[model samples]
Target: MAVDDSSTDPDGGSESESSASGPSRSPSDSVSAVARSVADPILEIRDTTVAFNMDRGESRVLDDVTLDIERKEIIGIVGESGSGKSMFASALLDAVVEPGVLTGDITYHPTPDESIDLLNLSKRELRDLRWEEISMVFQGAMSSWNPTMTIRGHFEETLDAHDADYVAGMERAHELLSDLYLDPERVLSSYPHELSGGMKQRALIALSMVLEPRVLVMDEPTAALDLLMQRSILKLLKEVQSKYEITMVFITHDLPLVAELADRLAVMYAFQFAEVGPTETILRDAAHPYTRSLLNATPNLDADVDEMKPIPGSSPDPVNAPVGCSYHPRCPLATEQCVEQDPPFFDAGPNHQTACFHWEEAAEEIPFSLPEQTDREASR
Candidate 1:
C-alpha cells in the first residue's frame, strides 16, 4: 500500500500502463518485454549452480539457481537464514569466495549488444559495474557505513567512483533524504552512529542511487529496524525505485515487506530458488513446500491467539543435503516419489512457479496445518 502511493517518478507510478509501442502490454508483462528489448538480457541467470569445496568435502551451496531481473521492477527473494538468502545476494555481484566454486550464469546487459558474464568478470570489470549498473545495499547496512565517515561523504564516494558531478550528487542526495522523510542537512552531517537505525538504512539506500545502477540488490536492508521503520524504508524504496527507475531485487524473510513492497517474489531454499511469482499470488497461494512453510510461519498480527501458524522441523542442512526433494524430509505431504526425485520448477498458476512434487494436492492442506514455531523462522 505504501509502495504504490509513495513512488512519484514517471516510471514509478505503481504498475504504470505498459506502452503500446512495446506491443500494448501491461506493467505485469514488463518482464517479458524487458527480456526482449535487451539484445541479450539485462540480468540473466539460468541453471546456475555454486558449490563449496571445503576440505571435508564438496558441498553444493546452490543448485540450479536461476532468475532474471528486468528494468524498473522490484523482485523479492524470500527465505530463512542458512537457506542461502545472503549467499544468493553475494553471488549476484560475483562476490562468492574461495572454497566456493561457482558454476552459474550471471550475465548483465548494459547495451542491447553488450553483455558480460558477471560471474566471470575481473575485479576491474566488477568495479566498473559497482554503483553504476548493479549496486548492493548489504545486510547490517547500518554498520556497513564507516562510523568515522559523514553520511554525505559516504554518499559522495559512490558518485566519485564514476566521476559524476559532485555538486549535483549532493543536491540529489538531499532530495532523496527528504523524500524518505529524513532531514537533509542533519543526515548529510551525521556519522553512522549519530543516525537512527532507520536513517542509516535509508542513507545506505541513497548512497546506492548515486550511480543509478540499472539493478539494485538489497539484502535485508531494514532487518534490524522496527515495524515503523520497516514500513518507512519500504515506502522510501518504492519512492526511490520510481524516481530513479532502477530494477530492484529485494532479499528478506519478511513476508510483510514482500506483500507491501515487491511486485514479484523469488523464494529461495538451500541456495536455490524454490519458487517465484507475483507477490500477492505467491503469498496467498504458495505452491512450494518451503514457501508454504514460510507463509504459515509468519506470525499473523490479526489472527486470534490460538490461530497463529508456524512450520514444523528445521531447515535442511545445505552442507549435507538430503536425498531427493531437499524439502521432503520436512514436507508434510512428501511421498516416496518426493523422496527419490528432486522437484523441478513447474507452473503452479498464472505467473507462479514451484519446485514441489505435490504442490497441487498439498496446497489445499497446508493452510489448515499448524506447524512448529522454529520450522521456518523468517529470522532476519
Candidate 2:
C-alpha cells in the first residue's frame, strides 16, 4: 500500500529538489529539517511519494513521507491494515518490491559528507545494505525461515552472506539465542518445522541482530503470538537493543504497543501521516480527529462499556482519496474548509505536529478527564 523515498514524484516541488532521492543522484539543494550536528541520523525521508498504476488510474499510496531517525530511538508507526505503515519502514530499508514506484529524498547520513541515497542505488547495493547496514524482522518470522535448512545452517548462511566466517558467527549467534531464552544446541540443529512458533520468532530476531546493524526495522514482530510470547519477545528485544544500541522502527496497528516501546509515534491514514509527535502527548492530547478516534477506540479496562468511543465508518478509498482532507468524510469536526483545502501539517509543540485544521479547538475534547477508572482504583 506504500512506496519508499527513492522512486516517486515528490510534492509541491521539481525533480531537481528530489534528485537526491536516488542513490546515485545528489541534489544541489538544502532542507530545513537537516541537522549536521546530529551525527547518528541513521535515515531520513523527505517529501516521499509512491504510486501504483492501475487500469483506473495511478493510485498514490504514499504522499510526502519523511523520516528523521536518531540513534537508539524507537519510533512506532500506527495505522490500520492498509494505512501504508509497512511501506514507510520497508522503503527505508530498501526492501521495497517492484511495481511499486517510490519517489522522494531518502538521505542516510552514514558518514559526514557521505550520504547514501537509497533510491538511486543499484539492486546489488541495496541488497548489500539490507543485511549488513540495515536489518529487518518481518511480520511472519517462522515463514521467513527455510524448512530445508537446519536452523544452525540457516543462521550460519545469513552471516556467511556478509562474509562472516561460520565458526565465530555461530558463536555470536549462540550467544544471541541464549539471550533470547532459547537453548543454543537444540535450536541451532533443529529444522524450521521442528521449532515452535515462538522459538522461530526469537531465532529470526537472533539472525537480524547477528549482524548488529545500526538500524533494525521490525514489522509487527509480535503479530500472531500469544500474550506470553509477545511479552517475552518484547523483553528480549529491549535487552538486545540495550546491548547493541540499535535504532528501531516498529510498524504496527497497536497503540498500546506504541506506548510501551516508542519514544515518538507517527499516525498514518490513506497514505499520509495524520499526526506525529511524542507518544505521551499525542496519545493523551491528540489533535487530529483520526488520531482521537484511534485513541478513543482503545479498549479501556476501566471505562463502562457505553462510555467507550467507537470510530465511525471505514477508511477512504486509496485509489481516489478525497481531494482536500483525506479524513474529511468521517471526521466529526469537518467543515467546508476541510472539504475544500487540504490542511498542511502544522506543528503543535516542540516535537509534535498534527495535520488537522482544528487542532487548537479539538485538543480539549480529545483529552478529557474521565475522573477515575475502576481498573486503577481496584488495583490500588
Candidate 3:
C-alpha cells in the first residue's frame, strides 16, 4: 500500500503502531521540497495521551497534550517537577518504556510537506527515524553511556549503527567538540566517569549531532550543571541551532531560561498544557493563572523584588488527578466551572492559547505578589 508521508490533515484520526508497513519516502516529498514556501511546522502533536500500567492500576502520565513546533525555531516546554515534562518528550521520541500506552497524533515533518505520523510507524521504521531524523539529549544522560566503553567507542557505535564512516564521524565529533570549547582529544579518549558532569553533558550533545538531525529534543540538558556551566551550555545550543539550522524542543522547569532562549513557550501543568504562546506575549501579559503564577514565582532581576514568591499547593498525583481542571485546586481564580468542567484552549491573542475559563480576566490582571521571604532564609 502507498503511504503519503508528506501530507496530513490537521484533524487527523489516531494511527496505531501496528497499522503501518515499512517506511518509504512519500509521494509529496519532492513536491514540498520544490515549493520551499514560508516557515512551516516541522512537528505537530494533537491530543497526545500517555498512560502507564502499574501493579496498582493505570496512571495517566500525559493527558491530551497538543503542540506545534516550527522549522528552525526553539520551542520551550516548561513546567514544575513531576508535571509530565520528560514523559512528553519520551512520547515524541517513542522512548516511553513498556506498559506505557500512547494515544493520539504525533506528526513529524522532514520537509515542508513530508509529514510522518511518529505514533503510526512500526518499531523498525521508528528506530530508523530516530537519531537519523530526530535526536534527543536527555537529562542526567551522561550515565547513558557505557561505563566500560571509551568515548571514541561510543561514537563508533553510533556512527556504525547509521552506516556512516567511523573516520568521518570522528572528524565531525572533533569539530563539534572544538566548537563547544572542549578539548576533543581528551574527551574522545576519556570514559564517561573520567570527565566532569558538564563535559559529559556536552559530549552527549555532540554525539546526538553526529547525524545532524533536523530536530534536536533536549530534556533539561543543563539541569545537572551549575549556573555558569548552564549558561555556557545554553550558548553552545544557540550556536548549534544557528550553524545546523535545527529545530529544538527544550524541556525544562526554568521559566527564566525558557523566556531568555525560546521563541515560543508551552506551560505544562499536571498532565496538560495550560498555556502556549510567544515568549514576549506570555511574559508581558500571560493569560492563564498558572502561567501567571509561574512568572510570579520566577524572580525578576529588572524589578525591585523583595522576595521569591513560590506557587502554593503541590501538584495532584497523575494516578488520581482531579476530575475537571487538574489545576483547579491550585489555581487562585478557579471557580465552580473550573472544578466541574475542563476548560478548552481558548484563543487569547495572535498565536496565543490558554486553557483557562477566566483567561480574559487573568490577562488583564497584574502579575501576582506573594509573601516576602525573610533575610535569614534568603542568605542561604
Candidate 4:
C-alpha cells in the first residue's frame, strides 16, 4: 500500500477524496456487500460505554459503541480530538483507570468456537490477555517510552512480565525491528531520547509486535511525524499486517492516512459512531451528514480554497450533550425530529449503517453545499 504523496496536502491538512468516480450506488447496496464479505469477526463490541465520575457530574466519553472487527482486517476508527477514539481503544484492552466506569460486552473470539468477554475477566485474566492476545501501540512514541530505559530493557521487561523465553523474544524483537527497516542492534542499545521521533515510533511498533499478538490496536501511530515519515510508517504497517495476518484497530483523525490503510472506516462523532462501512463506499458516498461534512471539510488538491468547508461549530460537550442527535446543531440536514428524538442506526447501504434520520436526504445532497434553513435556525 504505497501512499501517494499527492493524497495529502502540503499544509498537513486531513483527509482527501478519491479521484476516481463511478456510478452512484445506494447506501443500502453497500450494507449488503459488507454483510456478505465479513464472515469472520474477531471482536464483537456491543453497547460499549465509558463514563467518568467528574466533579461536575458523570461525563460520557464513549456512548454505546458497537462494531464487529473482522479477522485479519484493518479497521480505521476516525474522529475529532475529544470524540473518544483513544478511549475506545483503551477500553478494548480494559485499560480504563479509576473514576472511569466501563461497561459493555467486548467479546473476543480466540478461536471460532471459543469466545471471551474482556470486561468480565478478572484482573489476572485481563493481564494475561494483554500483549499476548491483544496489544496496543499507544499514541506519542516519545512519551510512551521511558527515557531512563534502553529499548532492549523495554523488550526484556515485557517478555519477563509475560514469562516468555528471553532469547526467543529478543530474536523476535530483532527480526521485527529489522523488518521495519531499523538497525536492530543500534535501536536495541539506544535509549528513548537517543533515537529520532520517527525512529522511536518504528521502535515502538516493533516492540508491540514482539509478542506477535492476534490483534493490534494502534492509536495515532504516525502522529507528529513528517509527511515522508508518515508515508513510510503507513507502508510499514500495511506490510506488518500482511506478514502477521493480524487484526488491526487503527485509531486516527487523519482520514486520508486511514483511507490508505484500512479496509473499512468507522466515523465517530460526539462519542458515538456516526457511520460504519467499507472504505470506498464511505469515501465515495457518505450517508450521515457528519460523515459527509468531514469529507467535505477535507482539503483537496484539485479543489479551490472556497471548496473546502470546515464543519460548523464544535463537538458537543459530552457532559451535557444535545437532547436528541448530538450532531443536530451542526448537521446541514438536521430537522426538528433530529433535535427532539435520538435517531437509531439506519441501513444506508450494504453492510453500511448510520445514525441519522435524514440519511436519504444527505445521500441526495451535494457535498460541501450550504446548510439548509432549518440547520441555520437550529444552530442559532
Candidate 5:
C-alpha cells in the first residue's frame, strides 16, 4: 500500500527538505511486498493477556488488551513505568521470558489471504517472522550492541542470520545511516563504544530498518539522548517511516515526547489501556480519569509550573491488583461503581474509546489542560 509522503516534521521542517537520499528497494522487496486485499488494520490483538508465575502467585503483567494497529500509521503507547508498555511490545514479538504465560490472539496480516496467529506460531515460525517481518529497536541501545563488534559487523551478522546478501545489506546499511544524517563510513567502521550515545541510538534504528520490516516497534528509543538529540531522533524516525511506508508502534513513558511523533495515542494504566484515540482528540478532550491525570501530571512549558499536578499514589502491584478497576485507586473521578466493576471501553468520540465508567464526568471532575502550542501545532 502507498502512503502519503507529505508529512511535516515536528520541528516545523518539511520532510522532503532532508539532505539524505531516499533508499532503493531491497533485494527481498518482491517477497515482502505481497498484495494486501485484506482490511486496513495490519495487526489484530484480541483479549491478549500475559501472566508470570512466581513464588507468590501468578502476576498479570498485561490484562485483556485489544487493539487494532492500522497499516503504515504511527501509534504511540504511553504510560508510567510498570504500566506494562514494554511487556506489550515483548508480547508482540513472542519474546516473553520463561514462566510467563501468554494468552489470546495476536493476528498478523501479511497478505490478502494470510493470517498468522503469533501466539500459535511454532518457535521456528516466530523466529522467521521476526526481523524479516517485524523488527524491534529495544531500549538502551548501548547495552543492546556488542562492544567488540563494529557497526558493519552488526549489519553483516543480522543479514547473515536472515540469509540475506551480505554485500547488498552493507550497502543498504550505509544508505540508511546516511538517511539518518550520520557519517555512514565512520559509523560503519567504529565500534559501539566509539560512537556517542545519540549516534548509537540512530545506528540501532538504521540496523532495525536494514531488513525493511513491515512493522517497527520502538521501546524508549530516545531514553538516553539529550533533549536536542531526542528531537533529532524523532524527526529522523518520522522521515524513515514516511520513506519506507512502515507501520510504527512507538512505546514511551513521556507523553509529550510521543505527542510530537504519534498519529494516534494509546494511554496505558495498570497494565491495560485507559484510553485510545486520535492524538489531537486525546490531547484536547481526554475522557478517562487516568488519561486526564496523565495530562495534568505532564509539565507543559507554556503552562505554569505550579499547574503541573502529579498523579496521586503509585501503580498497583500486578500480583495483588484490585478486584475491579486497577486504576480506581489512583483515579480522581473514581466512584463506587468504578471500585466495584471493571468498565468496558466507552465511546468518547468518533474512533475514540476510554475504559472509564465516569467517562462523562472525568473532564468536569478534573481540569483538562492542553499541551504546549508547539506540540499541538506539530501534531496537527
Candidate 6:
C-alpha cells in the first residue's frame, strides 16, 4: 500500500496523518519495501496534492496522490473528467500553469543516489528537465500546436529552446515521423489545420519525442478519433514503447483502452485514487466499490451492451468535498464508519491495493472471473 504524506485536506487536517498514528506499519516502510522490490523506478510521486486558488477560496484538485512508476512500463491513469488526472500529470513536470500550489514531494530518480526533487527545482532547472528527461503529449493537437507554425516550425522551436543542433533536430523529426508511419516531407510542410486529426496527433507525439525523453506523459492521446484511427494510434504507441523502452504515463477516461495497453491501472475518483493495482487484478477482481462500479459501467463488448450499469450521483465538489472516504456518498457498501473517517489504502493482494474499508465484503459482492492466463500474459 502507498502512503500519503505532507498533504492536507481543505479543512487543514493532514489526510494521512491519522493513518500514521495507527498500529499498522508506517507508510514509508511500505513504500521502501516496494521500492526495494522493483528493479528500477524512474519516478516516485509521494503524497502529491495540487490545489487551485479560486474566487471561492482554494479548491483541492488532487488529494494525496502517491505511486511508483517503473522504468519501462506503461501506467494508465483512468478517471472521469473532474477527477484530477490531468492535474496530476501536470504536477509531475511541475507544469501546473498558474494559481495552483502543489505540496508534498515528486522525486525523479534516474539512478539510485540521484533522486531529484522536481517540486523544489528552480525554473531554469525545470525547463531543462521538461523535454530532456520528461515530455508531455497534451490532449488535443489543436490546443497543443500553434496554428500559424508549421510542423517543422514547432520542431525548430522545441530544439532551439533546448539549444540543440538544427540539422540534427530536422533529422530526428523525419525519423520519428517515419516511425509513426507519417510522410516526413508532407507532415513537415503542413500547418496544424492542414493535417487530419489523427495526423496532427501523430505530429504532436513526434514533437514530444524529438528530445528522446525517457518518460512520456500523454493526456488523452487518442481522443476525438474514429475506431480505426484510435487503433492505429494505439498500435503506434505499443510499437514506440517496445522500441524506445521509455516509461509512459497514459491518462484517459477510457478504462478498457488502458487495460489493453497499460500493465497497471490507477482508478481515480473524487480527486483521489479509489484503487491502484495490476491491470489484470483490477479488471478481474476489483477490490474497491468505485473500481467495480467503473468496470460495471464500462461498455462490455463480450457481454450484452444493454446490461451496462451507470454509477449514481455526480462527483463531489473539490472545494467542499464530503468528509471521510469521498466515494462513501455513492458507494453501495458505505457504512457509518466509512462516512466518518477516511480509509487508508489497504493491501488486497500482491502489487494491488484499495482505499476501501470493506474491501473483502465488496470483493465478495462483485467477484469476476479472471481472463485466461495465456491471453493476459500475451497482452502484457
Give the candidate number with the greatest lDDT. 6
Tens digits of per-residue lDDT for model 1, 286-359: 87777877776777665565665566677665556677877777788888988887665555555555666677
Off by over 4 Å in 5: 1-39
* Candidate lDDT values, in order: 0.68, 0.70, 0.74, 0.76, 0.76, 0.77
TM-scores for all predictions: 0.83, 0.85, 0.84, 0.86, 0.88, 0.88
**How does residue 355 of candidate 1 score in lDDT?**
68
Which pairs of residues collide in candidate 3? 6-114
Give the distance in Å from residue 99's predicted Cα in candidate 1 to where it truly belongs: 3.2
* Cα deviation of 303, candidate 6, in Å: 1.9
The TM-score of predicted model 4 comes to 0.86
The residue-level lDDT of candidate 3 at 163 comes to 87
Per-residue lDDT value at 173 in model 4: 96
RMSD of each: 9.1, 7.7, 10.8, 9.4, 10.9, 5.3
Task: Please provide, for model 4 over 165-244, each residue's C-alpha lDDT reduced to its tens digit, 9 standing for 90 to 100.
Answer: 99999999998998899999999999998999999999998888888899999988888899889878888888889998
Q: Give the alpha carbon lDDT tens digit for every residue of 1-380 in model 2.
A: 11111222221111111223321122111232222213356677777877777777777767666646666878788887777777777678766566777777787765545688878889788877888778898777668787899988888778878787777888889999999999999998899999888999998888887876778889888898887787677767777887877888888888766566677787888778777667776766776788888877876655677766777877765577787887888887888988898776554554555677777767665554333432213323
Q: Residue-wise lDDT of candidate 6 within 27-116, one digit each (tens)?
A: 224354334324577888777888877776778888777777888889899987787777888888998766678887889986656899
lDDT of 3: 0.74
Candidate 3 structure quality by residue, lDDT tens digits, 1-380: 00001101111111111214421122212112212221477887676778876655667778766666778989888888888888888888887776678888888989986879898899888887888899999877978899999998989899988888778888999999988889999999998999999999998999999887899999888888898888778878878788889999999989877665787888888877777667777777787888887878787655457655678888777677788777889877888988898776555655666677777677556366422532212323
Residue 144, model 3: lDDT of 88
Clash number for candidate 4: 13
Residue 282 accuracy (lDDT) in model 4: 82
User: Model 3, stretches more than 4 Å misplaced?
Assistant: 1-39, 301-306, 363-380
